[model samples]
Target: MIDDAGSTLTAELSAYHPLWHLKRINWLEGFGASVPEDEPITTRVFLIDTGVHVGHPYLSKAIDAQLAIDFSALPFGLRYVDGINKPIEFDPEILDHLPLSANDKATISQLMQRASGKLCKAPLETALHTAFPSHGTACAGLIGARMPGFFTDPLPSLTDGKPALAVPYWGVDPLSTIIPVSTSLNPTPGQLILALVYALQNQADVIHLPRGISVAWMSDNGEYDNPGLSLKTDQDEAEWEALEALLFAISRTVPIVCAAGNSGENSLAYPANLSLEDKGENGIISVGALSSAGFRSSYSNYGPGLTVVAPSDDATVFNRYQIRINELGRRYRLHDYAGYVGAGLPRVDFSREAILSTDIPGQNGYTGYSPLGYDEDDDTFAHANDPLQGAFTLFGGTSAASSIVAGVVALMTRRAKMKGQILSGPQLKQILRATARGTPADTKADDINGDKASLELLFGSGLVDAGKAVGKIGA
Candidate 1:
């Protein structure tokens, strides 16, 4: 019902590959869910965004790259500086939507009609910003293919042999050994509360944000005290009171996942509105989106300070939803628009689409580096392209759903170091809210808040079942 013209809906869609267009020894014999090489599954994960392509080839040995962490020392120009920059397009009438393969629906409807005419734009280059491995090099090749020693170069090499899917930018800096600190722009709750007080005096476990604030720094006046106003007006309470003192000074000790925003409404997203009441810092979780049939996500952004939920993979209706509950079971409803497609609202690209991960390089041609003035390493600068391959890519928001839930919380800290019981940050968020995945059934209740408080506003402790959060961190 939606093909009025645009070349008959760009002749039915698909055709837009730039994450290096494919070459990493033939893209790891098909990406995503496949891990068995004697059961690998490493885990490091830092991805502060606007940087990471730490030598692609699916994730060059799992990227540590000799401490190269760059919290904006320069690069990160845009391409979504790391999360929710806007895309949406697909309302060609929704007969159950999900189609786009004709080269990703004529390259995402010619990049949303060239971003609605201004020649296309909005925070795009993913994989948490840049260094090049596009899509954070396929999400660090899905966490070095399921978390064992979390690669950066343990075995990956096969041009004429076999093991393809690449990785190798060993410079290093997965949070500069744990947060030394640097700066350029895009961060100012007094530098995210001085990098959460240098990552809680250094024993850092997680902080990742994949971009989720700047809609012109929110608060179009919702009562924030209007200094200028545009985000809608209320001045958004002085940036939510300096993000509630940087979320009670870094959830008391690391743990932060932000990104339940791509302008998806139901309001209350900033630092998950500093978790409304438990003002005692429980260690912040706040994810949203869910789609691969898990439900919820009509652009995610509900209330009661949302706690969890995942998979955000909508990619223009490609599917992935999450946070279930229906058939009189209850709990559903989350919309900005339901039927009539076009105005059927919901944004964060309907909870991100075609996900995948890891990919950086929005700029990387360094050599004559310059922190403030300039130094050496010339050859007209501009390096970053070694054995990493196109790195990896695929897009959508909540900034790749907060680095796929911080790479499943670094695979639950490598399954709590194979079980010795040392899990921190409020005991890994009380074992991810006592093993989430509940739903009572509200079947998208009029899209969200027309009843049942839109099921706790919008899936607070409902979805996020990454194999039951990796089987409750492997029991």
Candidate 2:
């Protein structure tokens, strides 16, 4: 559907399937020389997650390193903090399962000694010390991996030589900038709130959180929203109001894109579900995942308050994530690259189910998993782990989906900015809903059902159509 002079193509992409999403959104069609230089400055996306690896070639190219902040060090004793609900202390038992070699473990302890006197401590000896691996960077990559040549334009329609045809260039907004805030290795409610303020103060147009904040009582009836909620009071109704207020403030200015969680239930994840009413009018996007084949992912959360769907996987192709056969003849999902598992992470053969992006050089896998050797693709692992310099690894979940939407928002905002218009957060949400097409209705568990609008509960306004959204700007 290249309606313009071969500049853009509209194809339904597999979420963050930059190659896919870009074509579906017809991204390049709007790329005009008339855009001002400061458009990117006004359209920054702040990803509040694990913090980016800041080293992947594609991400490194796309992100603003100057805007990156590592809050993992700010919230003391949070090296292994995952969430307030899943509280993690620096447990001695974790010592036994650390994904490091003996020498690397010793090296971490020694590095700690050297960092003790420093103003801020070292990030981590490796990904081993972290509760999660590649969380922030993977999200960042999804938001801005224009990507390396392979990912940006994966499937190119060829010429039978009748006439020279052009396949539109594909990828997220290459011009957009990302401001990464690494809340913690494990983020608490306090850390999340702080991250929100920091991102807004720094002038982010979009705020993307990859995970769901577990709420004790947010089933569409709870009315507590304060912006001053603390770690100790995270579960308190009083504290939740504070959290909601913070979300409300951020959404008023910057569109807050959040994952709808992966429980596969009909429940909605908050902040994404942070509306006084259910249609999510407070500038929150409760993104659900669609497999590449245009069906609701079995693992994606649904029901009331959900905003839109994006492709993380395709049902017909994989029923989970959209898999791609790479140039190396290796089968993998897009952006979810193959790479090595460094120290301080749980070891498992992660090649089959993760999104690959920039990593802290020589990072580890997830925590508590046994160390693994190559099961099938030795060369892919070898290349990924070579001196562990590539700084690439895999990650997944609604976090990736949320960031993908954030990327689209960035594109929309940037496009609008160039046209002498500014899209407020609420307006952004409205545009997405108005422009979106219908997606597969929920039929997974057979009984998980509800209705928030005219459409089926699970799919929201359907899959987010980025091309249509941009087209609606100023209209």
lDDT of each: 0.42, 0.54
Q: For model 1, give the RMSD to the true fold.
A: 23.3
Candidate number achieving the greatest TM-score relative to the actual structure: 2
Cα lDDT tens digits, model 2, 1-475, are 2233243222223222325544443445543331345424446888877655554456666676555555455433223222222222222332243233464334333322332211122233443344343566667766776434422333343323221212222235556777776665444455565566556556777888887776545557655333334333434443345456557655766788889888766777766666335434478778987655444665677777788877674211222223222323333433344442132332211112333444444334321222322324224342232334434444456776677788788878877777778777888898888877773332222222322324547677777777678767755
TM-score of each: 0.28, 0.64
Off by over 4 Å in 1: 1-48, 51-77, 80-184, 187-207, 210-236, 242-278, 285-405, 408-410, 413-427, 430-474
TM-score of 1: 0.28
Q: Give the best candidate by lDDT.
A: 2
Predicted candidate 1 versus true structure: per-residue lDDT over 1-475, tens digit per residue: 1122223212212122222111111122112111223445443444444344443333444454433233332343222222322332323322123222344334333322432211122223353333332434443343333222324243332222333333321111121122113223354343343333333433456666555544343445633322233343332434334445545555544566666676557765566556554656456677776654445555666667776665554422212222222212111224422332444343222222344444443333211112221212112222233233222234445555555555555556555555544565556665666665556531133244333456556767765444455456545
Residue 169 in model 1: lDDT: 18
